[model samples]
Target chain A: MDTATTVLDLVGVFLNALLGGTVARRDRLDLFGFLVIGIASGLGGGLIRDVLLQHGPPAALTDPAYIPTALAGTGVAFLLDISPPDWSRAFKFLDAAALSVWASVGAQKTMGVGLGRLPAILLGTITAVGGGAIRDLLLQRVPAVLQDTRWYASVAVLVAAVEVLGIATGFPVAGTVAAITLGVLLRIVAEWRG
Target chain B: MDTATTVLDLVGVFLNALLGGTVARRDRLDLFGFLVIGIASGLGGGLIRDVLLQHGPPAALTDPAYIPTALAGTGVAFLLDISPPDWSRAFKFLDAAALSVWASVGAQKTMGVGLGRLPAILLGTITAVGGGAIRDLLLQRVPAVLQDTRWYASVAVLVAAVEVLGIATGFPVAGTVAAITLGVLLRIVAEWRG
Candidate 1:
């Protein structure tokens, strides 16, 4: 379970970093700016979650793979042109998957720390959306989650709520799976319909 | 000493909240916006620092006085018209004092937790400038500390460094006093010259 969690965490970081890198590229930012935005996008949510959890240094800082994965995502974005429509389709799916994983994991971690259900839900939502929010803030723009027509932040909130409910019903594993599945489906459907 | 620190912390929160409320007023934000900016400006830095410290929940959360103090500041700003030059002058001095207190206190708290000097300095600087940075982000503007022509972040860094040096020299009390004094003087002078 720990290993699976770690893998999912890294996957979320990488995809989010790529998304952030795309924004940096659009803004025509320099290498330094790419690194800053990419890292923040990849790790900012987890960092905020861990900090609020009163856990040790954020996993992004303490874990060896996180930073390198973020950098690798940035490198991929910097080196390759991913502006094609096909790439966008792929990115949307990947981003949805990442958000699902982060939201569930954030809720699980918060629950593990013995916090109440409300904080768990709040932190879970934050962990899913915080990176993109930070990235947007760095660009001096309103975060998409705050104004997105698609079910972005809403998907995260629902996923967190599902996870919290699952835990309450003593079906942690099933809850995670269900939450992720629901989140991915909702997000993709929202995007497609929009 | 504890009582003094608490007093200083509350004072900083009130002043920073007022500062944030002033900005919200200028932006013609609603009451909700004023409260959001005010609480964020007052407590955001300390919250960030505490989270990084891996301490228990942030003092701002655990302490009863903080949120009310912040709200009070916001209320004052909402009620009064303090757009005159005289009020601005008084605000400048109070703001300077608050900055100094927060910077030194942040460094001191970091050191008290048995962390190294570098973290101490980093956290200290964050604690001083983080609130305004967050307020700006919420407003979708670039943070002043990041781009201010005035030596705002620089002053925080210097104050933190001074605190770190004082601790290293086994003069913690003297360090806090000197750091605050230097910070206040430098900030006032910078504002005056500007």
Candidate 2:
């Protein structure tokens, strides 16, 4: 279970880093700026969640793999020639996937810590949308989750709600997976329709 | 000691919320936006600090008074006719005071948790600057702490350093108070010179 969670977490980090790097490139930020944005976007949500949950120095700060993974994602993003707008479809898919995984992970972690349903749900949403919000903020843009009418943060909220329900009713693992799948599909569908 | 700390904490929250509310108003955010920004700016630093230290739910969430204090600050900001730029001098003074208090409090909390020197200093700075950074991000501006050459974050760093040094050498309370005083003075001087 730990290994699976780790793998999913890395995938989410990589995708977020890519998004952050693309934003940096668009803004023509310095190399340091790119690194900062990439790392923050990749790990910012988890950091916020861990802090709110009273978890230790965030996993990103403690784990050896997280920073390198984020850096690799940023490097790939830097090397890529495709503009973010041109890769909107791919970005949307990756974003939704990452969001689903993060929301599930966050909800599970919060519940594991004995937090109540409301906190678990709130933390789940924060974990899903935090990195992107940080990325936009660094770039001096309003967070998409705040402004976009499409089901961005809403999808995470839904996933979190399902996770809490599943936990309360038993069958946590099954519920998490179902919620993730449902969230990704909803986000993609919303984006496509919009 | 607890009473003193609580007073300082409330003052810090009120000032930061005022700053957040002003930013929200300038950006033409609705009432909800005003509340969100106000609460985030007032509590963001402490939230980041407690998380890093593995502390329980942040005081802002646990203590009933904290939220209301922040709300009052926002309400006062909303009612005021003075624009942020127009009140720059007062804002600078209040910002400096808040920064000093938060940095000192963060360092003290880190030390109390038995964290080492480096983490104490780092968390201290985060506690001081995190709120303002969040405010800037929400307002779609580069964090002033990151971009401004001013002694803003630097002063916090210095205060944190002093705090750690004081703890390592003994005399924690005196060190914290001295650091706060020094940090506030340095910030005011820098603003005046700038």
Candidate 3:
């Protein structure tokens, strides 16, 4: 877990829980459905990553952070009843945040396991996007990446770039800053242009 | 990987694919979603069993039989434009078939791995129901288990009982016949009462 990505992942999952829960609520789902989405949206990515790595359950199951956070997020969404427009905005933020977090996490984990830079970058990309892909499949929807979403895949690349540069230069802070900056900027650019 | 459960686990996956895919089509899903449901329905129980056992992705990813059968089932449903009612009847049959499959698979896997019979039976029950539980969650519907609907869980227990009895008595064919008879009967009873 790259430090920045770790932080972002924590934040991203929390946000995902809220956003996914809100979406479930809008769909008029019952409590179990809401919690299911909240938990899934929050941890689905990591679970997919772990399963792929043959690691089993991953941090989502191993650590306690996600489940309770997601449960709380679901409760909040049910209580507050976020409107569609607001939910949409939250969704965009979540997408951007998750993209960057996944990218960095992917790269970091790949490198952590001693893979080469390129593979690390690629793994990072998959790690970041894996959860959403699983989520969409679960919901019976076309995955967002498969759809024409603006620069979705690019964020993952940018995540790798930061780490690749940092690894080359031996400046961990520089890599983190650069990667987060690139992801946030590109995401904002996509949104602003949209 | 339980020797006991392995008997029809492979066939169970294929049959459940047909069961799940038909249900998805009956629910009016498009092709891709239908395929997803088919795979989920077939693999869901086993996957759940594996995850709980910490042996994940289950046979869902590793087994050669599973993926193709699921795809074929979904393809057949789409090609035939299987009517909703006919699909529902298939669902009823599948419910019975899947339960038998899961019960044996679950008990064997759990017992093979050195777990107590109680846990094995429990795991088998979850294995039989877990996939449907997941599917319903994805569809934003209440899991039939959560409600007092039909003898869904009962079928799992019956299968487990047959398994337990066979293991106790050294009666292989008798055990299987007992399981099949119990599973099929419970399913028919559920349908008849409905």
Candidate 4:
């Protein structure tokens, strides 16, 4: 939980919430809709993280940072009166960004929780995708990860690879940095071309 | 868990899905919407169960029974297509039924997880409320639990109390029977009176 990581997680949650609320707002949702998408995306990662770790609720109810972070994000969306076409492109960027950070953070978090390297790698990937998956499912939309053909699974796979490689080679910092960069860059490139 | 408790839990989920989807269709939400509500109410309890257990994705994912059961219920709803009414009344009953069942099942399951009576009670209440809370939040409606004062919390409280007392007194069968009957009767009475 480095300051950088903590900030990243918070930012990740906040940004994800902002984008999720804004985009989902295009639908027929109302005030509570905004809150739902916000919290689902913001706390979704850690909630999945906790579930994978067998810790349950994943600090959602207990963690004040998450709820307020989501709340603030949703507020931004409501003020903006978002629609689908407005941020489709921006959403892609946000998705890319969330994927990158989540990959790295999720992996390291797995390690911190005392999971073996393999489980940690898997957990990291789950943490990254699980939130969005749940959100989409709740919205009654098919999950992007399951539908996309652009190797969406690779982002998670590569992150896990980096985690395993980092641990095995004792270049944890370097491995993580490379892994994060790969994720961010890949996601960005996908979004750019997409 | 005792055989009867388990049976009731499963049946409650199946029944709620039927009831919920029927209500959804009456609202003109289409197949997808009905499915959403059906699955949401059905998995609502287990989602909370998994979250509390830190098992993540709920047992619904692991157990093949959950979705199929819900889908079957959804089909029934489609076929039955309960007559339309004011959205408000249907919603109230949906919330009430789900809450009652969840309160009972959540408490029983929490105790089964080996948690203390207090956590079990709290978890049960949360479990009962959690799914609908999430569902309504996503739908942009104020959650009934947060908005109403009638017996939302009371039902959960009563269910948890029955489960705990049954466990403590070594009279679990009687306890569970009382819990279910009490929840249903109370909900019916509350709805009728109000």
The TM-scores of all predictions, comma-separated, are 0.62, 0.63, 0.60, 0.59
Best by DockQ: 2
* Candidate with more favorable, higher TM-score: 1 or 2: 2
The count of residue-pair clashes in candidate 1 stands at: 0
- The worst-scoring run of ten residues by lDDT in candidate 2 chain B lies at B81-90
lDDT of 2 by residue, B1-194 (tens): 38877787788999889888888887777665676688789988888787667668876655667767888898988788556667777677777877888888888888888888888889999998998887777777778997758888999999989888888888887887888889889998897887
Q: Model 3 Cα displacement at A170 (Å)?
A: 2.5
lDDT string, candidate 3, A75-163, tens digits: 88878877546656657766686678777776766676666788777777777666556556555567787864777776777777687
Ranking by TM-score: 2, 1, 3, 4
User: Which candidate, 2 or 4, has the higher lDDT?
Assistant: 2
Error of 1 at B111 (Å): 11
Worst 10 residues of 3 chain A by lDDT: A55-64
Model 2 vs. true fold: TM: 0.63
Candidates 1 and 2 compared by lDDT, better number: 1
lDDT, candidate 1, B1-194, per-residue tens: 37887897788999888878888888777665676678789989998898778779677755668778888888888788555244676677777778877888889899899999999999999999999898888888878987868888889999999999999999988988899889889988998898
lDDT of 1 at A79: 79
Q: Compare the candidates by lDDT and give the number of the best one.
A: 1
**Model 1 regions lying over 4 Å from their true place:** A88-90, B1-43, B52-54, B59-133, B142-194
Clashing pairs in 3: A45-A131, A102-A128, A106-A124, A107-A124
By TM-score, who's the top model here?
2
After superposition, the stretches of candidate 3 with alpha carbons farther than 4 Å from their true spots are A2-7, A87-98, B1-41, B47-194
Candidates 2 and 4 compared: the better one by TM-score is 2
Q: Could you give candidate 1's per-residue lDDT for residues A1-194 as a string of tens digits?
A: 38887897788999888878888989999999999999999999998888888767787888899999999998887877665254667678778888999999999988887776766776788899889888988897866664445668788889999999999999999999999999989988998898
Clash-forming residue pairs, model 2: A51-B51
User: DockQ, per-model, please?
Assistant: 0.19, 0.25, 0.11, 0.14
